[model samples]
Target: MKIKNLALAVAALYAGSAYALEPFVIKEIRVEGVQRTEPGTVFNYLPVKVGDRLDDDKAAASVKALYATGFFKDVRLEAEDGVLIVAVDERPTIFQININGSKDFDKDQLKKALKDNGLAESLIFDRALLDQATQELKRQYYAKGKYSVDIKATVTPLERNRVAINFDISEGAVATISQINIVGNQAFKEGELLDLFSQTTGGWFSWITKDDQYSKQKLSADLEALRSFYLNRGYLEFNVDSTVVSISPDKKKIYITVNLSEGKRYTVTDIKVGGELLVPEDEVRKLIRIKEGDVFSRELVNESTQSISDRLGNDGYAFANVNAVPELDRDKQTVAFTFFIDPGRRVYVRNINITGNTKTRDEVVRREMRQIEGGWYNASKIRRSKERVDLLGYFEDVNVETPQVPDSPDQVDVNVSVKEKPTGNVMAGIGYARGTGISFQASISQSNIFGSGKYLALGLNTSKSSKLYSISYSDPYYTPDGVSRGFDLYYRKVDPTQLSLGQYNTAGVGSSMRVGLPISEFDTVNFSLGIDRSEITLLTGAPQNYIDFVSAFGSRYTTLPATASWVRDGRDSALYPTRGALRRVESLVALPGGDLRYYTLSAQNQWFYPLSKTFTFMLNAEAGYANGYGGRPLPFFKNLYAGGIGSVRGYGTGTLGLKDSNGDALGGNRKVVANAELLFPIPGLKGDKSARLSVFGDAGSVWGSGDKMSFGDLRYSAGFGLTWVSPVGPLKFSVAKPFNPKDNDKVERFQFQLGTLF
Candidate 1:
């Protein structure tokens, strides 16, 4: 034999004496020292099978393979009488994961982090994995700028070969951004560029908003914002060459420096539409927002590209590609733009799959879809469908995805995923106004009852001055054509003397059934008819008008009231509107056959304009007119009342109308109110549209019978208010100073309205 062959044979023979007396043909394989793992699993992992000849090399190879499986901490192999024996000391399985001392994130979040690092419960306990999980936990804190965070992991072995993994974490304070410097910039000032970033160096509100924290993700986003800022300002060749971030020795302070190169500003020299124009060239050209001589704006260029693509998509071209290729003339500092459009194959939606509904019914969401299955994919329709579902207020979030079906180039599936919220509420609320002492309200309501998208509410409102009990039901989709039907039944009692409005007591019970017909996408017409019985009693200090009203109309009366209204709502959001306009007009007529005959007309218009992402401008106006009909006096109870939260916030509720002989507000037959507000994001809660602060100016007046309503007689007030959509419902508060107030105007400088949706 050769020298190498002789050495290998001698080594194998010597090594065989360690565990096996002699090499023999294997008859069977058996695994021992395993508690949870199956014997078959050990067999499948063995390199040598039952029929294989056992030798020193085979024994060593089998041991190595078993150890590599990670299921065993120790492995041994033995051979006896041609039988292979495999032994393993299995690693302890993780029985539970525990986290402590983490306030920034919850226990579940930490467990998820560990799970992502392969150190979750039921997983094998490996020291390497535990160390990795520790590092990952620290990394999460570091991403949040918590440089002082400390994380320690402990493994406690328990009975049944199981262990408990505990992660004790101390998430430290966020590192503050002490300074931000911009270098190698010539076109824009350092201050100007810094203002574009959401991360601030340090401010008074920094602690609340944490906008001054040094976070990697925030820094990355700020860099992108800077790039966009430069590009939008005509610096087409702006480039961020390098960025340097440094931390203090204590790891509590951070400084950032960015080096940038802003090349020569470029202007648009010419704009042209090239490539295939499936639509008319003129129509496509109109879609381009950029024109010749305008500064080169990357945002506008991208918007134009997306617009062209969307236009093509609307025409059944779901896979359209539109690119704005810029041809730059460095010498002239100008760019010639060319829009290339490619309308690919028309794709159709094969199915509209809805998931994550959980509680909401399939049809409830499907009915809101404007894009039908087996129809051409329309991007606009899909977007509108999402918006409609969002406006339903039954979901916390809605997401739509379009994925191309495999092996089908011209077909796609629409996946709609929704996160449901608490649509049913049973709550009680309390509020206080300057003049009105306190009010208590309780309600139970469901916007999505049993996932049917039906609204049901039962409420009781009790105040020192008034008491009301009401129940309402609404079916948003009463008909396939999108008509809505609803009904309201209410029993209300009002005591004006207790609230400082007027001296009278009125009790009424009424029911109304209404149907709303969709006239257009943004318009609806509603009709309702109801009968009410009201009883009025004059107190010792009752107003003269109240006594006169009772003398003419009697103490008890019944009336049939019919109403027709048209509403056009274009608001972007239902809960907190930021843009668009809403206009409504309604007329109510009490028939002549009733105890009292009267006709009332009212119109309301509101418009919202977004000045910036954080600022919005809103204007609202309302007017009402009431008169007697069929030779009967107008019912005093049906008169229009103004002032208070929905009208003029600085004044008492229903206190802006004409006064009686006792100088008490008697309400009126004519009313006009207008308000303008500047809405802005709360200082510490930027980007949260649910909470807003606004400065408003209000002007309104109410004119009684035989009186003329004019702008000159309006009451004016200016104030600041906060509107918040809290967990319970919307809460509104205002603090105002009246510009013009009579001696007995009953002005309320502070007013608040709070109620649960239920």
Candidate 2:
């Protein structure tokens, strides 16, 4: 009976085995519904593999791992006869993207924006991303003050689980700010506070500048400007309480109000410096702009800190930090400032990195850097390096950053990033003028040739009065010291009989070799040697002077000339100078071997001074004198001529020179011209220097041999001129009336040029 009980107990122990699960080993892993993904990719992401025991936990984890790859939207796992199966539904791939009805923004811009928002071509499509992209496009247009912009997105499925997304955008009318109100102000009037803002209410100039448009960036800038205005005027504790902006129901009008609390004005009681004085204390004190007993000015305090930091930077402390701590005494309304300075370790440049130059050679860019590698980090040198690169005109943008090297406290890497511009230009143009007739021109020029810092130009021009064929080559860095060498060869034919000038023609061939030497930061000295051969031919009704010159010296002559010139340019910009001066002096002499021996001296100077925020005063003067030497007369063809766009704008080309017996202009040997202009941005296009309007007054003249070059002999005109750097090229237009003209002067009131002046 006991043995029977033992057997029953054993049976009872085995009875629970029926409910227990047996471990099933996976024999193989199978991936289904994968159209583009590789089978190995699925296996790599699967948590449960072949020969592994499958369980609920492992199955769940494998499903999660597959979903986490972002390649599948739905995943299912099943076990059939110990073989694990992973079934997935993949998200559709983007086949094509189209954007329509977008005018204010570029199509590429929108595509890039969508790509940045995770909705690019060939990327797995997500419904949430499509919705986000639609809203993002709307936000972009709204930031430009297009409040009524509407954006719609459509997703159409293709055959092989692919989708085509189309974004249709409707950019509505721009929203303008109708009024800007400044409230809670006592010291300054509303008008005064509003005047300080670049953003204004609607005005006559709103259409061009669009300053009245509401933008978050502009609003933030205006707020900072408001703060600076109050802080600079001795308001020590001024606080901007609140700002309220409201738009009308139609989204066309905007109103803004800023509330502020004006604190008591404070005056400076004393100022002192506190820091590790690596330099003498007195030298640091001299750098401070704020003095005791002056009105507390935040600008001066900031200037003082910058001055201290710059002084330290100049002394090799590139990472210096200077701060101004002000202590205010409420009882006396007094403020005292202490400038704290920390001069960090003197850093050196460890490496120089150049980027974003896909076409230019690395050495070509490195040669322009002023901050040498393995040298002390000088901020001024770094800044000059960027400036030098910008002056190359090979790049549209140039930026430099000095990032400290990791694990090296006193070492930094200077990185230069540049956006390259088109270095070569091919131009073909046809121009017309009353004085010169119709002309056809074509030119090919490249400033950077095959990424080398070399220049080449080929040109051909055909005109009723002149025809030219020329070629030139230049190497800016002929030597390491920044010397430039170049050569020019040209053939030209001038037929004055086709125009209203003298009835004579001349054909010539010339070649010249030139060198430029950099003398200082803003100065250069150039020397050139040239040889020329010309033959003159007389047509019907040729001028007597030309007939006399050809009769005296024969029809053909060969000459050699040498020239030396000095130029100093301190202008802030080369293309559009706003404030600075340019001076050039040159002397040219024909050698004794030439048919004509003559010397010419010429000087040109232009100065620009900013009179206000918008207006600039410019003064330009030019003088030239040429005379014969070694008992030979100056070549008549080489005589100076004045008038036209480059001289007196209202007069015809070369019309202000000496007169001949046939009431035609005769070239002269002496010339003087003076011009004064009030330059300012166009009324609506304020701050756009690329397009400008100038009110100018010009006076100039030409004088023959033995004729005096005097101010009284100069012609005068007053006019306005427009200049634009357009998509095609630089354009200039002028309209003027001569102030005082002789009866014989040819008046050309309106003139314009397409390519270059004169």
* Number of the predicted model whose TM-score against the real structure is largest: 1
Question: lDDT tens string, model 2, 463-545?
Answer: 87898999999999999888999999999899865544676789999999999999987899999999999888887777777
What are the models' TM-scores?
0.90, 0.85
The digit string of per-residue lDDT tens for model 1 on 131-183 reads: 98898888888877899898888888899999997778777778888999999
Clashes of each: 0, 0
Predicted structure 1: lDDT: 0.85
Error of 2 at 525 (Å): 1.0
Pairs of colliding residues, candidate 1: none
